[model samples]
Target: MTLPTSDTRVETTVTEPGQRLLTVDGLTVSVGGLTLLDGVGLTIDAGETLGLIGETGSGKSLTSRAIIGLLPTAMDVTGSIVWRGQELLAASPAQRRRLRGTEISMIFQDPMSSLNPTMRIGRQVGEVLRRRGVPSVEVQRRVIEMLEHVGIPDPERRIGNYPHEFSGGMRQRAMIAMAMIAGPSLVLADEPTTALDVTVQARVLEMLRQVRAEQGSAMLFVSHDLRVISHVADRVSVMYAGSIMEQGPTVEVLRRPAHPYTKALVASVPAVRTRTAIADPLPGAPATPADRPTGCPFRTRCALAHDRCVEERPVLRIVGTDRLAACHVAEEVSR
Candidate 1:
C-alpha cells in the first residue's frame, strides 16, 4: 500500500495549561559509537502527565535518566534538556544535585532495588528534608505524614521497618512517598507498578494521581502498557527505536492513533469487557538503537512502508489538530 504524505499544515488546537516545565530538544545519546537516542524531543507543561510508552529497549528509561542526569559518565549526550527555562545539560553537577530530589524526583520501577535495604523507611524518606536543613523534628513529622498519605498503615511503627518488612505494595508506596516528600516540580515514574499485582497496581496508580494532584507536579510516566498509559497520562508519546513515532493528547492518540506503530500498540491492548485478544500482535521484535535502519526505523515491520519510507526518514510533523507523527503515511493511517 502506497500512502501519500500530507503537505498542508494543520494548526494544533490543543491548549496546554500551566507554564512550560521541560523542553527536550534534539536529544541524542550515544555510548561506544552506538546511538541510543536519536534527536528525540518533547515538551512537558507544569502539572501535566506525559506518558512515554514503548516496548523494551525503546530508550524510554534512558530518556528519563538523561533528563535526571543519571546516565554514567561514559555515555555522551548531545541535547538541550531545559528544565524551567534552565538548560539542565549545561548545569553544574552540584547544581544538578541540588535540583534533584528537590526540584525533580524519580520513582524507579522496582522499589525493592531502588530503596536501600539497610536503611529504615523513615530515614530514607526523611533524608531529602534532612539534607535541606529541615529540623530533625519536622523531618520525622513529615515523613510519618507522607507515609500515612500513601496508604501505609501505622506510619509511626512502620517507619522504623526496613524494605524487607513492607509488602510489595507498601514498598512501592514508600518509594512514592520518598519521591513526593520533597514536593518536586517534576517527577519521573519509570514503571512504578511493574512488580505489583493488578489490585496493588490500581491502588498505586490512584495514589500517584492523587499525589500529583496535591503536589501540582509535572510527571513523565514511562510504561510499555498502553492500558496503563490511558489511565494515568494526560498526553502520550509513543517511542520506537529511541525515536518518537507519535505524540498528542492521550485520549485522541489512544482513540485515533495516527502512526502505524501506535495502531499496532492499540490493537494489542486486550479489551477488558469482552476479553477480546489482540488478533494481530505486532510482528518482529522492536528495532535495536545500534542497528536501526537508515530510513524509517519501523519500515521493516510496517505494513504500509513504501519506497519513500525506505529512502527517506520521516521527521515528526503535524498530522492532526494536536498530534505529531513521524511516519510518512501518518495522515493516510489516521484517515
Candidate 2:
C-alpha cells in the first residue's frame, strides 16, 4: 500500500540552522543515596539528531527519562533540562504532563512491553490525540493514515488488530507512528530497533530517517552500537559510568577518539568496508555507577590511566574544534 503523503496533525516548520531545541546541563539522578547519572549534560539542536551511545547500564536511558520527566518518584534528580528556553525541572506535574506527549514523545526500547497487549492497535496509536479531545473519527482516520505511512500492510484492516497480531518490526513502526502522530518537537528514541534482526533493523532505521526529515523533529537517539550511531546521529555523546566521556561530531569522534575508553570502543567494532582487524576486548569489566572508583570511573579499565587519573576527576573540556572530552590526558590522546 502507498504511504500517507500528508496528515493535518503532522505539522512541519522551518527552523534556523544550529538553533537550540533542548539543553540539558549538569543532570544527575540518584536513588537510595547512590548516584546513577553524574553531572550528565547534552544539547540537541533544532531538526538535529543527537545520539547517546554507551553500554546498557551507563545511564543513557536515565538521561532520556530525565529529559521527558519520567523518572521514578523515589529518585532524586538535580539538574536543568531546558526545552526552547523553559526549565523542565521547575515545571509542575500538570505542566510536564501536558508537554510529555504533545511536545516531547519517547519511543521505548521494547515495543512488545511498551504497547499494551489488551488495547487495540488503533486505540493505542491514537491515544494521545484522543486524550487531547480530538474527534474520535478524526483520530481513527489519522491513526490509520499513520500506520500506512509507517509501512503497515493494509492498515485499514490491521488497525483493528491487537499488538500480538503484528510482527516485531511492525509493532515498532506502530510505536513510531504513535510518537510522530502528535508532531512532537523532540523525539527521544531509546534503542528503537534493538529487538529487530539486521534486515528489519535497516528498514526501521530508514523509516526513522524519513520521518525525521519530513517532520523536522529533533531526536535523542540512544543506542549501545557506535556503528548505528554513526549512521543516524549528526552528533554523539559517549557515556561511561554515568558520565559523558566524549561529545562531538559523530564522524570525528569515531574517526579519532579523544578518550581511551572511546578509542577502545572504536577498536572493538569490526570495519565493514575495510579489512581491518578488530582489537582484543577491553581487560576489565565495565564499571557500575554505584561501585565506581574515586577518580575517573573508566580509569580502572583504561590503559592510559596514570597517577593523575587516580587523584583527580577529569571534567569535560574542549579538546578540538566543537569537541568535548573528559580525560586527564586529552591533549595527548587527541594527537
Q: Count the backbone clashes (under 3 Å) in each candidate.
A: 0, 0
Clashing pairs for model 1 are none
Give, for candidate 2, the lowest lDDT window spanning 10 residues: 272-281
Best by the lDDT measure: 2
Cα lDDT of model 1 by residue, 1-335, tens digit: 11111111111122234879899999999999999999999999877999999888999999999999999999999979998779999999998998878788998888888899999999998888888887887788888877887778999999999999999888988998888787777889998888778986887787777655655678999999887898899999999999999999999998888999998888877751124765467888888966799889999989999999999999999998889999999988988
Error of 1 at 163 (Å): 1.6
- For the record, the alpha-carbon RMSD of candidate 2 to the native fold, in angstroms, is 2.1
Best by TM-score: 2
lDDT of 1: 0.85
Worst 10 residues of 1 by lDDT: 1-10
For residue 28, give model 1's deviation from the true position in Å. 0.7
